[model samples]
Target: MLDQDTPHAAMPGLEIPESVAAALSGWVQQVAEQTAGPVRAALEQLESEAAELRDTGAELEAARDQALAASSEHQAEIERLTVELRDARKLATEALVSKAKDQLAIDGKDRQLADLRTQLERNVAAQGSESDARLAAEMELVGATTARDNFEAEVRTLRGQLDKSYAERSALRAELETLRGKK
Candidate 1:
């Protein structure tokens, strides 16, 4: 047993021989020296991996934010196009109604001119008035046909635009879904 004066005898009843303690200390020192380099290298590799993970996280966050912004813009554009398409459809309906009215007027005028032509077959003065009526009806019909064609073309263009808007919105939704899936 070691006496109180021994350096390793601080704990009572646990005294060790000087030579045995010295050998144990030496062994511990040797083991520490042997493992220090590998332990430090492992710690350094772990720190590097953690740093890389943090950088990747930041980049992923930025990309997600950008995708969200783009999705917002696409939704707004789709809504605006929807409103414009609705308005164009209303205008096209009015144009169709106007065209139908013009057609009815033209049919009535055609019938009246036919009657006049038949009666004027024997009167030269009446024949002149009949030609004038026919020319006026032709001009009116031409104007109405041109207006109807223009409105039909506009409707077709609006439909095409609406289809494009739907497609763009669908693409955006798919992108958003992909982003969410990644998360």
Candidate 2:
């Protein structure tokens, strides 16, 4: 009898003649060949799936990069717009301040003209049609009146300019507000 611990006795309870052993060995080889076909098919399918996953990962990475670039571009545009808006606001404020100063100057001129007219009236009342001095005083009054009229005309022109500047400033503010609302 063969030693039970030998490699040939590893299949327990299998007593085979030499011819039977040869036939069984051929059957095992056929089974192994059949199993190998399915195993190779399964390995090929797994490799195809892995390749698809890699391609998909690459596509996803490309999409992520595109999204990041677009976001950066958008942020840059926003920064540019913000700078332009600040500049516009600064210009509008300067214009308003300039207009206010012009209006104040016109008011001062108007006050000066009023004081001159009052002084002339007092002089006329004090020297009631006396002589050549009175005539000279009347002439002076006429010249002062002309000067006052010129000053008033200048004031009117300044007021018109102020009004135009204010209108322009208002329009700019409205546009700024609209831009801010879009954000």
Candidate 3:
């Protein structure tokens, strides 16, 4: 080990001339400068890549937020559609019930028409056998004819009612179909 205060005797018996020392120092500096340029460029490129990654992360976060908001809106729309569908189904059911009631009434009217026809036929057959009963039979026939005409008119009115009910039912069915198609 050499004394800290001594310069020329720093290393024993090792003398370096000023000119050769200066040349070695210059070569070391040149080598350091060359290597530092590539190192600084690599550091700058790394920093640029890191900044890009941060931007990508932020964009991904924003996309996730938008998707969540869209999903929430779609869920709300689905709930609203479900309520509308239920209402349409209820209306369809009520229309079907009304149609059934109208059908029953028409059936009753048909039965009444059949009974009136049978009675008229029996009255006509009775009038053919006896002269004394013939006059009474003609009066009975007239009354039966009037009753038949009234019943026929009532049948026509009931048929009109049934037709109106059918129309209403058709309208309800069409509305239901429209609602379903929206889904």
**C-alpha TM-score for every candidate:** 0.73, 0.49, 0.48
Q: Specify the highest-lDDT model's number.
A: 1
Provide the global lDDT of candidate 2 against the true structure: 0.61
Instruction: Tell me how many residue pairs clash in candidate 1.
Output: 0
Superposition error at 51 for model 2 (Å) = 1.1
Q: What alpha-carbon RMSD in Å does predicted model 2 have with respect to the real structure? A: 14.6
- What are the clashing pairs of model 1? none
Candidate 2 residue 40 Cα shift, in angstroms, is: 1.7
- Residue-by-residue lDDT tens digits, candidate 1, 73-183: 877877887787788778778877877887888899889988898799877689888888889888988887787788778778877877886787678678767766765
Q: Candidates sorted by lDDT, descending order?
A: 1, 2, 3
- Top TM-score hit: 1
Model 1 TM: 0.73
lDDT string for model 2 (1-183, tens) is: 878687673556767899999999999999999999999999999999999978876766665566556556555655665565555555555555654564565456556556656665778763343344445545655655565555556555555555554555455456545544543
Better of 1 and 3 by TM-score: 1
Residue pairs with colliding backbones in model 2 are: none
The whole-model lDDT of each prediction reads: 0.81, 0.61, 0.61
Candidate 1's displacement at residue 153, Å, is 2.7
Worst 10 residues of 2 by lDDT: 126-135
Clashing pairs in 3: none
